[model samples]
Target: MNKELITDITKYQEFYPPNSLKAINNVLKWKNSEEELQGTIEALTFIVNQTLMKIIPEGRIVFCTMLERLDGRFVLLDEIQGVLNLNNNQMGKNIDELKNMG
Candidate 1:
């Protein structure tokens, strides 16, 4: 049987050169046997889903760090962060004043 090749192209943006039309398009063509269609569908599905997904991640900032040394030299850093975290505006003003004093 002479098989007819059918195709489905999609509109999808990808990282490419500014003048590249291939950046926003993917070509999926069905050819030969039915077995090959599975691979084509999977490829097309992946490309379509990837293009639809949010490129930029949405997440909360995780603050988890230990700042204490065995000798206790940088122990004040955590304490200062705690105070500044509680009142940043007031602490920022106080820090400015302290800097001007020197």
Candidate 2:
């Protein structure tokens, strides 16, 4: 999925917090079959949940409800790959910060 697609979902901020909405939308824009969608959603949700769990000080950031409202799983995988493709140094630094926090 493209960042634009994720940003497109950000338009729905009325439905979810802007950051969570962007993350969910980033994953949902990808087209996938129902069975694949379910598993992909599960895995992607776990990745996002884990990342947040690593970085955040406390509380929870739920994705399943927002994901159910849209459509995706591999979309999450694709979005993550998209993140990996990013060249921004700050992204790596942020990840380092998370690792250090953990």
Candidate 3:
């Protein structure tokens, strides 16, 4: 795995635990196999969505919006920004505006 990707995955360990990382790594090791990669991606996506929902419910929507974009499903970035807006009141004051700073 690339160092940056490994670092990113490691950052999620608190949420996913080491066992989840092992499973994901095993699956990604076989990523050269098309079927395996597809299955692994599906499983990982599920785990990610579930974990994020618990950690940050509003962020889950934003993450899913990006996931759709990653999957080439034609999601508009603005739509994701809108979801963030709706959830921002619960998040914090000034947070909604901060998101647009990107």
Candidate 4:
């Protein structure tokens, strides 16, 4: 039995415990969720802001951000570059800088 006041408004208490970060099956109906997704977003933002900032300065980093659409296809969101000292456009090529240098 759902404890929700409205049919589409799902209260996440059924799925998540207090302060829980686990998504479980909640991701399937992610867009329909009212509040829990916001909490997860905040948690992700906190992680990116707090932890990634510390690690990025240690090396040249390239990463991709992707979004999964409702039709189950993933779309490229953006490419993240962290402190790459080169001024060359090398997209979509896997260049092993260490091997190339040696």
**What TM-score fits each model?**
0.23, 0.26, 0.26, 0.31
Model 2 has how many clashing residue pairs?
Answer: 2
Candidate 4 lDDT by residue in tens digits, 67-102: 111267544443223223324344212233322332
RMSD of 2: 14.7
Candidate 3: minimum summed lDDT over ten consecutive residues — where? 1-10
After aligning candidate 1 to the native by TM-score, how far in Å is the CA of 42 from where it should be? 0.3
TM-score of 3: 0.26
Candidate 1, which segments miss by more than 4 Å at Cα? 1-31, 55-102
Which one is best on lDDT? 3
Off by over 4 Å in 4: 1-27, 30-32, 56-58, 61-102
Off by over 4 Å in 3: 1-32, 57-102
**Deviation in Å, model 2, residue 87 alpha carbon:** 24
Ranking by TM-score: 4, 2, 3, 1
Score residue 30 of candidate 4 by CA lDDT.
48
Backbone clashes in candidate 1 total: 0
Each model's lDDT comes to 0.35, 0.41, 0.48, 0.36
Stretch of 10 with least lDDT, candidate 1:
56-65
Clashes of each: 0, 2, 0, 0
